[model samples]
Target: MIKIPFIVSARAGKLLGRENFSNPEGAIIELVKNSYDADAKSCLVVFDIVFKIEKDEDGIDKKILNNDLSNIYIIDNGEGMSKDVIENQWMKIGTGNKETEFISKDKRVKTGAKGIGRFALDRLGFKAEMWTVSNDNNGFNWKMDWKQFDNSDKSISEITADLSDNDINIAEFLKTNFNHIKINNLFNEVSFNTGTVLKISNLKDDWFEKDIAGVFKSLEALIPPKELNMSFEVNFQHLQKPKEFGKVETAFFNDYDYKLTAKYDAEKLSVDFVITRNEMDIDVIKKKFSELYKNTKAPYDLKTLENKVFKYSKSINELLELEVDENNNKLLKDLGSFDLTFYYLKYNVSLKEGYPFKSISQKERRNVLDKFGGVKIYRDSFRVRPYGDTDNDWLKLGARVAQSPAGAGQRIGDWRVRPEQTAGIITISRKNNPDLIDKSDRSALQENDSYEIFKNIIIKVVKEFEVDRSKILNVFFKHFKILNEKLRENEIQRRAEDLVNKIIEERKVVEEKLYGKKYNSVDLFQQKRDEEERKKYEEAFKDTFKAIDDEKIEKDNEEIVQIRGLASLGLIVSSFAHELKEIKNNFDDINDLENIYTDLVSNESKKKIEYNDGINIIKSLKLDTEKIIHWVDYSLTAVKKDKRKRGNLNFIKYFDSLSQEWKNVLKNRNIELVIKKDTKAKYLFRAFEMDMNTIFSNLISNSIDSLDMQIKPAILVKQHF
Candidate 1:
């Protein structure tokens, strides 16, 4: 066999760094993740922007000069690398050391899997320097000019970085080099023997206040949920505006209207949903959730409802490949158990200081949602990218709601959830769900059977939350509507009072000007005239209010009339449908009439030939009559009084009847409908029969509609009963 070496171009480094990170914020986050993997208890990000201020056309000073001199410092009090490590793992491109040693010395799971995270520094700046002190107190300074990597003529192996050993004092180093005093003082306070400091200069992007704020917000999300108690801290400081940036804190969970905790059990093939109604804002709820799970570590409060447990449906379990192995142990093929905590809120923009809005202002709550309002996924106490991003709608919730908008009512499927209205975290670990792996770029989970099942289960849990929340929110909406109307009326009354006062003041001014301070019969006459004027104005004000009330009453009456009309129309339609069904039952002799015509045609030989075509036409017409009868029967069944009432129902039997009802319809379309029961047990459930019909009919209809262009279309309804 002939061996030929594959030449790696120097440009590969640039591709790995700039191409991997879409923005500077993402590149900075990668470095922070690296710090976490180093077992860092605290990481500090300082944006030391050196710029000259220039007055704009509006005479406002702006930092738009010398932005190229901006420097970013990312310092971490972690286990810094030694010389050997720098030469081997740190120097090597795409090193597998992290893959082999996935856990840190502190027993923290390594967050950075792709060894190329170091390249993030290159993405941020053309030149970079690293000052690191190892556990042995031996310090090393490494420098790299990333611009050299752009030389396409040179191979990656030919390029080299500079590394030198040095004696470093943490305090002395900051005093000598660090220009940002606040950040410098912070590092001096934290005593650490082993740590790494990255001073990146010759920046690629101009650092502005907004850009720095974005970085700060990203850092806030970088911290794992407090329930994990990871004890890691990240501080952000801007030299230009030091007060605005500080310790990265999470968005307030106490502001949530509803908290839903959902957990799936792999062994039991069951899912549990616990919903807690937070009278928080109701009482300005501010406490965090407290109970900690065995696998997923988070402490949440135990203000919970009676847990609702649902077993996996037959089809869902089949997709999961639930089975018993040869050793008599249960086995789940692709899917593992996962838990999700979701917080939902309905924003009130014009909130005033009161019971539900005391702790936080409306603006503050809106800002929080603007920053962190989407569902995010965390793996091994670290977040996965692009899943919960503002632009990333992995749940397709927006699309779902766009297709069928949610309304302010308590109806199944009517109150669809929106992406912005919720914030949540889904925690998964590599040990439990090895199949659900991230792609090399760490953008999202690999789209496989496991991922599909995972997304479906999450959406299912969210839907359950939506159903319960709709009932509560509708009442709130109605109360708000009434409150708003009362407030409007009060505003009108206040305006009326202001108008009457203004008129009285004008009359007094005119009277004072005309009647020249004469105390006598003239004063009395003026007083009498003023009293009459006051009474006339008061009467006009009352008349205006009366007119407003009359208009409101008229509108209310119109709405009542419309509702009654709709109810009467529905009764008429139901009556007609029943009468049509009765007529079809009594018209059974139509088939007998067809038989008589057939006999008449068959008796005369000459007429039989001419009537043969007519007879076939009559038969086809008879088939059309059968279709009409089927539709009428189905319509009559729908309006039955028993179906409208709620009771326990066998879902499997219901499906069987539903299938029979649609049997002829499907046959005409040449589509097959199959219902398979995995067990003999009755899947009894309490619900209105009409509700069940609505749910399944819509599902089946949508399924059939989508299959219009597919070949050999069929629907298989599988039940685990």
Candidate 2:
């Protein structure tokens, strides 16, 4: 954790010498608290003008009028302060009256804490004087001259002393116990009983530059009475109250009241309207509603019921009978219910006393009238405008509804009612403006365009609400749809597995028919006889060759050698015949073996076996076949007694043909083959071409078998010189 150091000293001077106010209105508020503390029912502030004339050096007079300064005096008939309180509480700069036991009866209602309100006079002027009489009939008079404490050397001691006879008497009464004062001077006199008079002179004239009306209007709105019993007065006069303007009439309507009401679930919004009998003439109601609901076409046969009033008392009944006809056919049908009511209001006009009628100006009256401009909505005849006109954002109707349970008052039409259900006593005036009426009519001439904006907003909100509900339903349906699709897919997968099993069974039978049996006795016997004959032929050939080369002592021994060679040739021929017979038998055996292996490999049961098992079988079969081929080649070579030779071969042609044949073999196995030769070279004599061919053939065959087991097989054959 990071520890934050608290710098007590750094913040100590933050509020010191600060004005404790941002505007003149704040200072005035402090003064009001002082009056309340004094227990005064009413306090009046007076601004008095005192002029001083100065003469130029040329002896011509010049008027030196200071608008920045004014003499402010506050008079109240309340329990006054005594000499001790004036010195210790009133005149003291930092004395805390709130902490004193005798100063206030209610601790919660006290506004003063530092008792520094007296310093406010210091900002306006250079001096202050307090005069008062105690409520106990004890006279006390006092004067505090801040100039005496001021560092400036300016003084009016000479002027004040010349009037000492009058000033002294008033000062004695304020500073000590005295019944009355006999001062005859303008500045020295006791004016009231058990009250305090505070005079602040040499006020900064800039304080008078503010718009007093504007400030007062805002204060009135912010501080509305909760019980609707308190009335506020500004500049010693009451504010002009709101008044109803006029009743708009249409054609001759029914003598019964009509109501309209609606409720929305998503927004939790509810709206109700109460209309009185003849409150709206037929023509006016239709015209206004047409503008409000322009998107809705006129109902057919609506003229017959144009001046009629709906009679249903309950919302449910009204919804059942509700219908709109257009073009001689019913165009609108309702599915829900609504409630509404109506009434007429009388209007009276009043204005501020000194305000001019024609030249009053918008700035002077705008703040006062704007507070009551909006239509007041009510739930139970109590005002619900939060903070009155101070809150301009009229949205949050749902929020107000939520708060209604907390016992908040509702606004009844244009009146603000109390929680006790008492009506507000503030009387307002309503003045009709014929010019405004004419303007409204002229602007409404464009019937379609005039209502287009409002119509769009209503339609947008309604559609948005519907769309939200539809989205919820769509999500619900989508879940079930996905579940159904999953079920269908599972069924398909199961069928695919069954079909695959059936295919394997059928393939096994077909493979058995194509290939023969394995481990036949006939094949083993023939292979063993071939191997024995090959060995015998090799032994006989060697013996004959040894006799012919016993002693090539003389060149003439050729005849004997020839005889030996011929005898050897005869034995070789006999051996060759036997070998040929054996070769034929071995060939038959090999054919049987190939058939058995092919049958086993191509069987459906084998196809279903794992890849590793199939590869092991192929490897074993290849080893056995290679052994058999080697034995046959050895037997043939011994009988023929042929020597190994080498010959040049076109490697390109060989590889090309080999690749073509390999491709054809791979096609049967569903494998692809590619063979490449680079810089083919002729070989020196070493191994015979036939032996090489046999070796390569076995290797290629084994490679092909290995590739056949793969899903997509590819074989690459390459030869380098």
Candidate 3:
């Protein structure tokens, strides 16, 4: 057995001035909450401001002014209350109907709690009336005067309503005053039905002062409900349909989608985001935003708050989209959808709670919200603002407003609106929205856990896109092969360069030993020898050494140049392999030139030809003269020598090889490569196979290094000669 404890309060502290609304906005929100608790599918709020002439104490005729008259009506189709319920629940103060065991037929419990919600009506109008009809019992009608509650001298009887109203004129007046409440004067009606209506009158003059219509417009646009499916109108004209805040128009490289939408309201700033499925690989969105808004300081210096907001908003799709398994099947039989909306409002620091009335601590306020502010998240939408308490830092200070009510909170757990209750809320508040434009949460940008998750998702998507395992494996093999080939080429180039340098040094030593005595002797015997003989010998020696040094330098330079060229070629080959593997693991037909190069490199062929013989042979060939001409032209091009003095053979080769290996890895991962080159060139001098290989490897490795990781993983290589 259990007993309920009863508490009592003195009547002196019971009633106060009707205008204890604190603010007009809060008063309106209370009314809206009531409609929602009643399970109203749609609620409409209309503001009406009526003007009349009144006389002052001096008997001077003065017109009492009004802003608007048609805006003071709030209509809903929820379950209307009976006359008795209206008197006890609607008119009476401190009566707890929400605690009663009144459950709807659908088994859905009510959301309203505090008995003081009706008291919020005091902010709207001076005089008020309520008309309702229930179908479960005999039909009845009733109305209450707000002015009566404020009149301390008036007895309770005067404030109470009489259900007996049968006069035709009185009925007409009631009908005119309460259009939302349907009733006939001929018979009393009272029954609990499926629909309910509420009409309020005697709107406060200040109700129209804050632009009620504008507020509704903003609310409708900002928070479009999917469950209740709301519609709003000004006067008789319906409001325009709300548009999505962010939409991706262009697909970026790597199939990453980018979307951005921004709104600026004096001191309030907001940005919406959407990223492509794969684009989540990198956490660059926050970086990009920081760069964009770096010039402006964070409104409240609330780094944590800003970060939470950005992260939550950016990953909205993840919350709404269904999860899929490796087989591309939905993980859950039923999926949930979510819609998030962020609001930012700015107010004076002095208005905030816990701070001095004359001076408020902006840092403290921001810190408080960053710690705990705005609405908590649920699965589909926010629970509502101020879920835990009204002591939020930002809200207390009147700085900002954020409403996201998803997550573990009970206030927003309405199954009718959110069928799958697996959502969370993230609300952030700042001193001024404009501050966000300048200040950023550097900590959020540094965090990489979320990025790791995003990368895994991208990898999964890539795997799904590539269904043919054989093709994927082929690409892997081809990439590996190209990488190995590039590594070999790089080694050959390094060896060639070293050998060229050694050969040049040896040649220099031989030349110096051979001509050293002859040159010295000639200088000494210049007067004794024949003039023509001396001149001819000197000229010949000078020309011979110059040509030798030039050849040596050119060979060394060729080794480096060729290595770079080969690296580029290797990258192209890897890309081609990736493409071929992706398209059924079949390679494109090799061109005759490519085949010739492959055979030349693979096979040892030592065919010596004089300069004249080579020229004659090219002329004799009838096949495409252009090809031969191009080959000859390329052969004439000069090669550049290595400029760096340090010679770390292993390091150079290792770096070149690593570059090629990375390219191969990318190809294995399903990347593509393309290559373009000028006509092939012939070598005039004999060169080692190692040298050629090294040149090819270095060139290809460099090209592979330039490939972008985010793009379709493709590389393009172009060679001049």
Best by TM-score: 1
In model 1, the Cα lDDT at residue 77 comes to 84
Top candidate when judged by lDDT against the true structure: 1
The total of clashing pairs for model 2 equals 34
List, residue by residue over 1-721, the lDDT tens digit for candidate 2: 8999643331222123134543444455456456556665444444443445679999888655354444555545456776667656664446765645424442223435566676555544545555566655555544444444332333222112001111223233433421221211212432345666566675654332233444344334323233222222222211111121111111111221222222311112222222112222346435433333333322212242363332212221122233333421111111111111211121211243211112223442333234432222221111222212322222222222223321111121212111111111111111111111111211111223312322222223222222322332233234445665576456544554455446544655666667743333468885686457545554454454444544444445577566556545434443355455565466455557656766666456566656447566656766555555454554454333232345555566655645654543456467777765554465234444555556666887787666647587666767665
Which of 2 and 3 is ahead in TM-score? 3
Q: What's the C-alpha lDDT at position 590 in model 3?
A: 23
Error of 2 at 599 (Å): 99
Instruction: lDDT for model 1, please.
Output: 0.73
What is the RMSD of candidate 2? Answer: 46.4
Q: Tens digits of per-residue lDDT for model 1 on 1-721?
A: 9999999999987797677787898899989888898888888887888788889999999767374667898988899989999999888888887777887899987876667887898888888999999899999999999888999999999888999998796556866776766776776777667889998888888777778888887777767877567868788888768788888886547676677887777766666667766533422232321112112211122222212222223233433344545332233334777788888776763455222332335676667777877898888777788778765667877656644454634354478777777888888877677788988666689997778778877887877677665654444455555777788678766766778879878766776789864334458886797678766776688678868877999999798767556444444445476468776775566677777777766456636566777767767877777777777777767766678779999887898899988987887777899888855677898989988888888988898888974466889877753
Decoy 3 TM-score against native: 0.32
Cα displacement (angstroms), candidate 3, residue 211, comes to: 2.8
| Poorest stretch of ten by lDDT in candidate 2 | 427-436
lDDT of each: 0.73, 0.39, 0.38
For residue 589, give model 2's deviation from the true position in Å.
Answer: 99
